[model samples]
Target: MKWTHSRLFLAIVALIGIVTFANLLQSFYRPYLPTITSLSTTNRSDVHENISHEDSASRISSGQGVKNKNLDICENPYLQPGYVWYSNTTEETNTTWVPFYPSLLDESYSSTTLETTGEPVDPYTSDGDPYFPTEQPPQELLDVSPHPWMQDIVRHYKLYNSSLALKQGGSSSRSREVLEREELENRLHWLRNRRILIVSDSVDRYQSEYICNRLGLELINSNKGRQTASWCHIPMWNLTLMNWHIASVSPTKPAWWWIQSMQIVNVEERWTEYYLPTLNDTIGMNGKSPDLILFHTGLWDHTYFIRAPEAIGGKASWARSLNWRELRFYMQRVRMVITMLREQFGDDVPIMCRSVTLKKSLPSNVSILNLDRAARFVCNELDIEIMEFGEIIRGYFEFYKDMVHIDRGPLSVLWANMVFWYLFRTQGGVEVRGDLIEMPSNGTEIVNVAKEWNTCHGDFMNAKRY
Candidate 1:
């Protein structure tokens, strides 16, 4: 009886050992099992189809799933025709440029004749359009808003480190490089999974380059892509920066004589052809549009009005019958461009007009400055914001070269920082008035400057109709 009991006990102990061993094995392999829902089983074609039916806002938020480990972070999926890379990195990516369904403009995209007369419609006319149709003047727009969030943000920055503000006294004495690196890191964090589009001349191209340099982003193509389109990418930030060099006028055949000879009309088409495609590339119906767009075109227009020959190292002649007398018409064209952009991107995307900076060497400089003012006046009509660099740079001719371009020291840094600040200030997920102060900071006061655009763009169909 004792021997039988011993054998039975041994069997029971062996059964217990098997159960414990199985549990240990299970725990070891559990983590290797899929923690994230994999999209591999989902058809790629279906993903594309789903994007098409979705709206812009809807598309932007679609990247809510687990970050895919298989996707190559180094690869630029949205790279346009001209972008090229000079270097490569092997580091694994933690952030991603979430894939988006490109939003192609449909039949709703329309073209209108920009009124040749740049004259502001009579404020008391039967139409009853205000002098500034959509918003208040620039300075006023800055004030009397929802807690002056932008002003508050600027105050948050200790930009006295800039040599220009030496008298401010509170500026940090840290090396400019250190400050820029810190600023870039903060911006990259905020700019993750976003894009920035810069439409400007060579001067602003330098601004774009400076930004890329600060971020340690290499210019992939350097000077090589479409003259109108140049792109720079930062894989770490998942940020794409592009420059569309759309000047004041379009380049046409027969050179400077094209304007007088009337060889080509609809001069704006030159801009639209290049601008539209590039802009289109940045937007996706079921994905996202660029988070910010900064634009400037008046300087080239200044060159155009002078009719300066390219042989004398002037900008390409693209103006169709544009002259000083027709400054009003030029102004109208500018407004139309702004309106078209707003119409395409929707009012939510912040479009900024870089205040024009003039070069003393240019002819009829006073009129050029006047044109800048006229352009700002039109910006208010279109409900676009002004970056105020023109106002900031005004009367500081010593810091500018050839009268229009800013020298590369403090002024350049200031302009880039301003662009950075404006973007970061308006970006989502930032602390708002309610978060900081004890004010009743409901979002109702957003339209204080532009009453007409206060209507929400909740319906894509309705927005398309507009």
Candidate 2:
């Protein structure tokens, strides 16, 4: 009986040893086992599709998912082109550019104390300390409003910096050097390496400041003083956005280059001396000259020099009532400035003359309107392009922050879209809408956008039913 019991105990011990050995061997091979995989690469296409459908606003919150590694060759982007203004107010199936609403919900987005600095903030990343828009925007529109312009900027900003919105060039497996060369092609292709110069007054300055902030350019060194130049550059793309405050397009001072080149140019001394040297400095500072030049000058000329009201002693009207001599001289200078820019920047370089913005004050407003009409005539003669900046903001005089500047929130975003959309359209990345009218090249009368804004806006859809 003792022997049988001892044999049973040995048998049980042997069974235990076999089970332990099997488990140990299985443990060694556990990692190598063909079990479930946590990697979801197979779902990447599905994820890409899902992310694509979500509105541009929610794109920011989508954290750490598999990114579409391949930069897509952007063939057709949803850029609507029209002479009339558009919005996505009623939630139509067809998306308008207005659809990009930035939704960053951090409370830090709110403005704490009112700042009267008079410069517009980047609606995308306003810290509220320095970047706050004037006197704190209407809390109603900011806090609970459906379309937060500030938040909306981020959506577009991100799209421009991403793979989704297709820019006009390149598709290839390339060496680093080859890739950079391809990128340089995107300068004119996407306005990436391109530089633009805006030679004007304070009106343009507000837009420049806002644009720099929106695009992540450093602004600490930007000059805010009158008649001086300010610069913003991004090295990665080699883009330079420069604004030269030649407050008076018809400079009282003669330009050095003009004096040297033309023995008897115009009675008005050239501003080339002051403005051109500054352009040189801009080129030196950025290691590149401007690819495009946006030129304007009217308000300062109207108030400061052009029209001083017919004095109590019977002098002349205050920048209004049409000083024929000064107005003619103004037109001549407008002609001269364009001629000078063409001569200096080379005829190949495209120069766009903006339709002069109307100052809110009456006498000046009339003077400004005349300037716009006169400037348009010159632009047409010079074969230059016009950005209906005047047309876009003329009706929104109520939105004028300082009685001069108009676009701050979504309007500023519109400014960016207008500028860049022209680039995209001209470069063949975007197509013009068949529905809207192009600026009448042969417009006989000065296009009064202010009077016609409402009528023109309804032209496509309202007429669709009619």
Model 2, 50-139: lDDT tens per residue?
322333334334441112112111111122122222333222111123211233333434444434443445556445445543232333
**Candidate 1 residue lDDT tens string, 438-462:** 1112222221111111211111112
- The backbone clash count of each candidate, in order, is 11, 16
TM match of model 1 to true structure: 0.47
Each candidate structure's TM-score, on Cα atoms with residue i matched to residue i, is 0.47, 0.49
Give the Å shift of residue 382 in candidate 1: 1.3
Tell me each candidate's RMSD, in Å, in order: 21.1, 23.4
